[model samples]
Target: MIVPSSNLTMETELPRMLRAREEAEPGDRFVFHSARARMQHVTPEQLLAMNQQATRAAAELADGRPDVVATACLVAIMAQGPGYHCTAEDDITGALRAEGCSAPVVSSAGALLSGIAALSARKVAILTPYMKPLTKAVADYIEDAGIEVVDAVSLEVPDNLAVARLDPADLREHHRKLDLARADALVLSACVQMPSLPAIQPVEDEVGIPVLSAATATAFRILTELGLPPRVPGVGRLLSGVEEPAA
Candidate 1:
């Protein structure tokens, strides 16, 4: 995981969401390594600056020769506009190649897009911790990928650390407040930094639709890219066996 320096949620939540089942083999567990990029705000300038560290971070992690690398900041890539995750993934792959290593790379932005597609969700609702402008960027970014953002609510938070400090229970209430009648899926955390891993399944049960967070989507994409079964229970509908979208 390559995350923003001020974003404290991914490392904690991802491991919990992806833990090996109790009956698995001794070595069946997945190991995670992370690299941090400097970021304290959700603005365009800060996002661009934070993204500059991706290549170097990829190179550093490639030294371990892991199965996959994930750039786990969603808004950073989305704020770059549509299709930027491809560019970001390419950059990471290039860096790994330069280090004489190869591993599939996934970005939170790309994973979210792919997860939504795998669910075949068209009209979707989103919950974001960004301010209005940044939230709009995320909604537009998703729209460019052929999905419709039927409704979106922003928390209008500026401090990245504060966004991390948000409670998952509060997220459940916010999700309940969304107009979910027509929404095919609910993006519990459009931004990776915001904490929503624990809220995913409960909210889905409450709303009777798929609910997913960027962290879980990235985990599902990583497992898919590695040719592993995506049977992660308790995350959401996406991981319980939603076939990977057609490439």
Candidate 2:
């Protein structure tokens, strides 16, 4: 996975979500390798500039012989408007190909969309650690991908490192603030930098809806694209072998 230099949650949560069941053999376990695209803030300008390093990050991840690579930034891709993951994925592919690597690539933005679709989610509620403008952009991006944003709550956090410092338990109040009456799914962490994995299942149990985060969705996309059984327990409903039409 490739992420912003200051984003810390993906590296921790993604690996936990990707781990196979304990009964599985060693060969069934998946290892993750990551590279950072220089970024220290979650603002639009910095995010747009961050894409300039994705190709280089892809090339660096390619050096590890990874079977799949993912650009693990949600708002960064969504900030480019709808359907940018295709172009972004193509850019990474070209960069990796140039380095004699042909591994498939996925983006956190696309993965989140795919994951919501897999859960058959239509109307959704989302929580983000981004400022209001970027949160609106993320909601617009998700809506453009065919999901309705019924409600959205932004923590209004500006500093990238501070987002990483937020405790998962603190998200419970934010989750309750969303008007989920008409919502079919809840995006607990629309930004990968914010910690939400520990809150996902509990929020789902309380709200009685499928809960997911960018990190869990990205791991699901990676396993699905790799043709592995997309089953990882204690994460959420999307990873429980849910199926949808291919992207």
Highest lDDT among the candidates is held by which one? 2
Clash-forming residue pairs, model 2: none
Candidate 1 lDDT, 1-247, residue by residue in tens: 7899997899998787667432343445778899889999888899999999999888889889988889999999999988999999999999988998878899999999989988989989999989999989999999999999989999999999999899988997888667888899999999888888778888889888999888888888888988877667777899887788677
**Per-residue lDDT of candidate 2, residues 1-247 (tens digit):** 8899998899898777666433343467677788988899888889999998999899888888889989988888999988998899999999999998879999999999999999989989999998899999999999998899999999998999999999999988889999999999999999899998888888888999999999888988888888877778877788777875665
User: Which residue runs does candidate 2 get wrong by more than 4 Å?
Assistant: 20-27
What's model 2's overall lDDT? 0.88
Question: Each model's C-alpha lDDT?
Answer: 0.87, 0.88
Per-residue lDDT of 212 in model 1: 86
Off-target runs (Cα >4 Å) in candidate 1 are 20-27
Give candidate 1's whole-model lDDT.
0.87
